[model samples]
Every structure is written in C-alpha cells, then in structure tokens.
Target: MRPVDGMRVDVLEYCRVLASQLRLAGLPESRVRVVVQDVLAHVEATGEDPVEAFGQPTDYAAQWARPPGVLRVLGLMVATAVAFPGFWLVLTAFTSPVPWGGAVRVTPFLVSAVAGAAVVGGVYPWTVGLWLERRAGRRVGRGRSPLDAVVAVLTWAVLIVLTLVVVQRVLGPDGDGRTLFSVPRRVLLAVGHGGMALSFVLPSPGVQTMPRSPADHRSWWARVRSLLAGTGNRRRF
Candidate 1:
C-alpha cells in the first residue's frame, strides 16, 4: 500500500480500538462516538499517529469515562415500560376485530411485562457498569468494590425471579387484578404510528453533524436563485 493508505489503515485501527476501550470504560455510546470522531479529526488534521498523539486507547478513554446519570436511567425505565405495552397495542390494532373507539382490556401478563421491562431498564446500566469497571480496572465512584459485581448480579437475578413469580402466581390466570386500564384501539394505533413517524424525523441526542463545506454555506434560497439563473442562461443560449 501507499504511505497515505498505510496511515489511513493505522488511523482506522486506532479508532476501532479506542471506541472499544471507551465503551468498556462505561462511557455512553454517544459520547464514545463524539470522542472517536474528535480524535480522528485531530489525527487527520495533524497527520500524527493516534497512539503518539493520544497516548494509549485505554488511558485516553479513562480520561473521559463517566457513569450515566440518575435522570437518564429513570428515563430509560419509563420508556421501556411504556414501549412494552405500546408495542402490543400497536400489534393488536391490526389483528384485533374490535372496532375503532372500542375498549380493549389490558391483561395481567402485559402489566407484568411492563414491570419487568422497567426493572431491567433501571438495573441494566448499573450492572453493566459494575462489570465494565472490573474489566477496565477503573473505579466508578466511592464505595464501589469488586464484591459489588456479585451483589448486583444476585440482586438482578432475584428481581427477575420475583417478577416471574408475580406474573404466574400472584397475578394468576385471569385474576381479579388483571385489567389495569382500557383504551380505544384507534387511539393506540394513532399514538404508535405517530411516535414512529416522529422518531424518524427527530434528531437523536447522540447524532453529531459534520462541519459544513464552502458549498454548503449557501442558503437554500441562494441555491434556488442560482438554479433559476442557470435555467434562464440556458434558454438564452
């Protein structure tokens, strides 16, 4: 390979290793992408080897690694709970014979699934972080120890078992506490489709826009005007 091609290969390998280390350090995927992109951009600008410029990947990741916040964890739990039922509701919209505006009964299993999902969503990050800390040789915060991993795993297992027991025994098959709420199938369909559409249009928090080039500096109106001028010139010719 040419010298430039070799440098490119080295940079790509470096970035791949850096991204893996950053993830193993418990940094969120979004932050990991941003950091990796920044590093790649710097390397391209200066044409320096990534290892020389940024020390080792693990060391660099250690500098930026951080645990996710409480609010983020809570939000994930809420989203998971909501999505669990929302998916079923959407599926039922197409399959069920119930007419629009008719009430659909919520089952105990659905509620249990939502509860399970919420539990998993909340506990997952911390558990994964504990494991990552063990792998990365870094402490997340104060009061954390190697034993925390074992404790977290045990707690997670217990919670899962309890959820399953509640689903099968306490809830029973069509028990009195089965029906939680009722909503129209049409409403469910609308909400599901709308949410899906919004997700496509909305920019995620993790997405980073690349720097615009000189050509992209022109406004839409300027581009339109230029197109019109070119068309007029073509007609004159």
Candidate 2:
C-alpha cells in the first residue's frame, strides 16, 4: 500500500480506539463519530499522524469526559446498553423479506434476515454499527459526559442476534399470525433503497460543510449591489 493509504488505515484504527476511550469516558457515539470525522479531516488536511497531532487516546478522551456522579453514570449505562439497542432491533425485526421488484431473491429465515440486514446496509446504511452507535448517542443527555459510548457497545453484539431473530419472526410466512411482520421490513427496505439513491444525488457531506472563502462572507445584497456598481463603472470607462 502507498504511504498515505497506510497512514489512513492506521488513523482509522486509532479513531476506533479513540472512540472507545471516549465512550468509556462517557461521550455519546454521535459526538464521538463527529469528533472522529473532524479528526480525519484534520489529519487529511495536515498530513500528520493522529497520535502526533492529537496526542494519546487516553489523554484525549479525558478532554471530553463528563463530570461523574453515580446516578448519571448509571442512567447513561442503561440507556446505552439496553434502551438504545433494544429499540433498533425491534425496528429491524419489523423490517423483513424486503422486496426488490424480484431483482434479488430472498430466501427464508437465515438468508432472508441476512439479506434484509444487507439491504438495510446497502441502500440506507442504517444497519451500520457506527451509524447505529450515533443513533444511540442521541439518547444521551447534553449534560452527561461523552464516554458513555463505551457502554454503548456492551450489548450490541447480543442485540444484533436478537435483531436477526426479530427479522425472522417478522418475516414468517403470511396468512399466519405473521401478516403484520412484513410491514416494518418493507419500510426498512424502502428506506434503504431510497437513502442509497439519495446519497448518489446529494452533494458530498464534507463539501457541504466546508468553510467558505473569506471573500464569500460579504453580505449577499451588498455583493450583488457591488457587482452591479462595478459593472456600470467598467461600462462607463
């Protein structure tokens, strides 16, 4: 691999470590993801190693750690480990046997569930562990520390299995008590395909958020009027 590619991979690995440490310190996953994105951008822009640029993960995590009390810590732990993952799995279960206009065949049970998860990942990417982590981060209190994300993954592995079960149950053959099961799964597929399509059409997220040039900061009306005045001046000359 090229040197830059190697650095990028190392940086990505470091980001995972930083994220874990940050979560252990109690930062929510959304904040951690954003922080990681920012770190990536910074590293790419500066062409520097993350550790050299940002310091060690442990020390960096400390910067974002929330003030700890027993109550808040405990509450956040439950929220991350249980409530967050539980809701998503239930939602995932609801989405099953995603239709694809017969483009891709979905087998029953294991194949169906795996296909459903992949569909969710391919188009919508909602099944992504990182994205889901960010979603869980939404439940965190603004006042709480960000390291709670560490506890966030505590139950995800198991929850993913449960999600598979739910998808199976939801996708069980119709004309049985399973009629309502397909509704959620269809929605999941719809969302997945729709999101994937939209991704291609939309501008890149980084570019959308990129800082404007200093000159672009001029008031828009002022800019227009100035342009007009300049045009008239050139014409007169």
Candidate 3:
C-alpha cells in the first residue's frame, strides 16, 4: 500500500476508517464508499494520510468495527431487559379488567399508567444507546437497547391520549364508549402504530466528533435557517 508523504499511514487504511464511520452514521454503503474515495483523493492532493488527518486509530476502528459480535449480543440483551416494563403494561392494557363498568373513561390514572410504562421501558435502552455511541463510538441497534422496546408503548400512549383529547373536545366529555371505539378511533390507533414503527425502525445515529472540513460546509442560507429552527445542525448546515 502506498503511504501518503509526511504521514505514517497507508492510503487504503485511511479510506477504510472513513468508510467505516460513514457506514456507522447510517449512510448507504454505496454512498459511503464514494465519499471515502473522495476524501482519500482530497488528502492525497495534500500528501497527507486521510485517517491521521481526520481522527485517531481507535476512533476509526469504532466508526468501522468495534464491540464485535459478543458486545452486540450483550447490548441487545441489556435493551431487552430494560423494555420489560412497557411490554407488561401492554399486556395489562389488553388483559386487565376494565374500570367503571367498561365506560372507556379517559382517566388520569390510565394516562399516568401508560406514561410510567414508557418511562420504565425506555430509560434503559435509551441510556445504553447513548452510552454505546458516546463511549464505544458506535450506533446501537434497535433490539440492542431497552429503550427500543419502550418506543412502541410510549408512542401508543401518546397517540391514545391525543386521540382522546380530540374526541372529548369534539363529542364532549360524556361521549359514550361506542363513539370512543368507533372507526375514527381505529384510524387514529393505526396512525399511532405506524409512528411507533417509524421511531424504532430507523437506524440509530452514530457517534461523531470529527472536525468539519470545507467540503462539509453548507450554503449560508441553509445555515441561517437551521440556526433559526433550533434543530440539530450536525450534518447539513
């Protein structure tokens, strides 16, 4: 492998590290490969190794491959353990006896119960994901965190509460059970389920701390808009 002048690393090794990070960041493999090649060329022009210019060896490895198969298995196990409470709440929702003679009352207790499920079930997985990304420098997968389990239950709870609020507003507080469980409620529930799937199914964002480059910069207008929006401007803008 050819070494870049004034750098102690091989060109291929540098590309390997860059490509690995792009992959972790949830970029498509084809796109990541293309970006890695472009970065390699950019560094070659300056006679410098891309990996050394970008980050340390451990950072590159974590971006590309770390935690191995065993770590992944353990991480998933931890996630599953954390999500148990939410799963139990779901079971309770369907199996437990209805209160107030099945009147479908939108009670505070019910809302709190669901919220508790979300908190209990989501905390561990979310923490694990955050920890892995920060300390291990990798994006933990959905099944790899307890928070993954809570996403669906929490989404369900939020959707249910929102739907109930809308319904109560439209039909009044004394709305009957029949109206509450009607076609409209069914549609809302379906939407909630879809949201749950989306929240969990998307790939996790990877750990990233590399300094931006000229190529990484975006248009000034985009930057201004992102600043105003107050959403994260990590990548774009």
Candidate 4:
C-alpha cells in the first residue's frame, strides 16, 4: 500500500478507487490500467488532487462504462451451465459398458450440476464486483481478514448442502428423471470430444486479453503474496 515515489497517499487512493470503479463497470484490466495511468499522469503534471481534478471516481468511470448486453450475459450463463453436462456426457461415454445404442437416463446428479452452474454463473460476477468494491474502500495497507475467508467458505458449504438436499428430495431415492433422447455411444463420444475441443478454441464472452507483465515469470508463492498485498504492477500508481 506504500505510494510510489512522487505519488501522494491520497493520489494513490484515488487511483485505487478509479481502477476499482472501472473494473466494476466491466472494463478489462488492461483498459482499466490505461485509464488509471492517464489520470495519474494528469494529476502529476498539474499537481492537483485527483478528486478535485476529475470529480468522484465512480462518476468519472461511468463516462467510460459500457455495461455488457443482456443477451451476452445470458449466453455466458447458458454456456457455463452446459459445460458440466457436457463433461459428464463425455465421461459417461468413455466409462459406460452398456451397448452403444442404449438410452442414458438423466439423473439427479446431472440436474444438480446444471442447477449449481446456473446459480454460480448468475451470482459469481456480482459477488466478485461487490467484494472488490468493498476492498477498494478499505483503508490503505489493510488486507483481507481471516473472517472474510471463513465466511466465504461457510457460505459455499451451506449452498452445496442445500443444493444436494433439494435435489435428493425432488428426485427421490432412485435419483432418476425421464429419458430425453437416445444416441449411440460412439456418436456421444464424438460429440463430446468435438464440443470439448471447440470450447478450447472459443473466445469467452466479455473477456479481454491481459497485457504481458514481468509478474508472469514469478513463482506462484510470489504472485500470491503480491495479490494478497495488493502490490501488483497495476497498483504501482
């Protein structure tokens, strides 16, 4: 949290807030950095307080914000939800000893996986944005507390238990659901592998390429420490 040379503490704070706001506005890290650096350079040249120069960080960022489209968000969520079932289909195709033409019943576990993926896809973005927003407002030099970790773990555990309970209740002891369609095992295998390969080549929606950095060569522990300390290259301002 120490300010870089020639950067005041308040100016550093302003940069942090601006970066956070830009990220919350759905700007990629690279774009956020470019904007933040421009602001920093302006403040440095004029020797003006950032808030005085640019107004509130949130308001300033709103000018540049391009919120993702509803269709794009929904598409991402559907893609995420399908990934689990796709993986399961591939695994089952490989392992099942049943005849190639046999029908595969949709099970409760599959249903649960889809439901979990949908929930996660819908909630994860907002949760992360809120977490980062809160962190940005915290006093400089303060890191995440142990209680935050505990609460996060507990929340996930509760969600998992509840999902399993509900799935079990609805699906009963047999955990069976109606058969949707039948396909040959060979066809399933081919489709599954093709889907997996396509997933690797496909560009994820809303993701922007990150610029290369020296930190990419650092050890995992070093990277973890930098992240925990909030002292990455992007934070130098």
lDDT of each: 0.55, 0.46, 0.45, 0.58
TM-score of each: 0.49, 0.29, 0.30, 0.49
Model 2 CA deviation exceeding 4 Å by range:
1-9, 24-30, 67-69, 77-237
TM-score: model 3 vs. ground truth? 0.30
- Superposed by TM-score, candidate 3 places the C-alpha of residue 151 at a distance from the truth, in angstroms, of 20
- Which numbered prediction scores highest in TM-score against the true structure? 4
Tens digit of lDDT per residue, candidate 2, span 1-237? 022333333565556656655654556655776677777789889888776677655456567885234564444333333222223333453444445432222345434444444433332222233333333232221212355444334444445566666667766653333223233454445654554454443321011121223224457586568668875233211
Worst 10 residues of 1 by lDDT: 203-212
Candidate maximizing lDDT:
4
Clashing pairs in 3: 79-145, 79-146, 125-146, 125-147
> Residue-wise lDDT of candidate 4 within 172-219, one digit each (tens)?
654245444555787777766765665553333223233223225567
> How many clashes would you count in candidate 4?
0
Better of 1 and 2 by lDDT: 1
Q: How close is candidate 4 to the true structure, as a TM-score?
A: 0.49
Q: Candidate 4: RMSD over Cα atoms?
A: 8.6
Using lDDT as the measure, what is the rank order of every candidate, best first? 4, 1, 2, 3
Please, what are the lDDT tens digits per residue for candidate 1 over residues 150-207? Answer: 8657776887788778777866776565676777877878765654554343222222
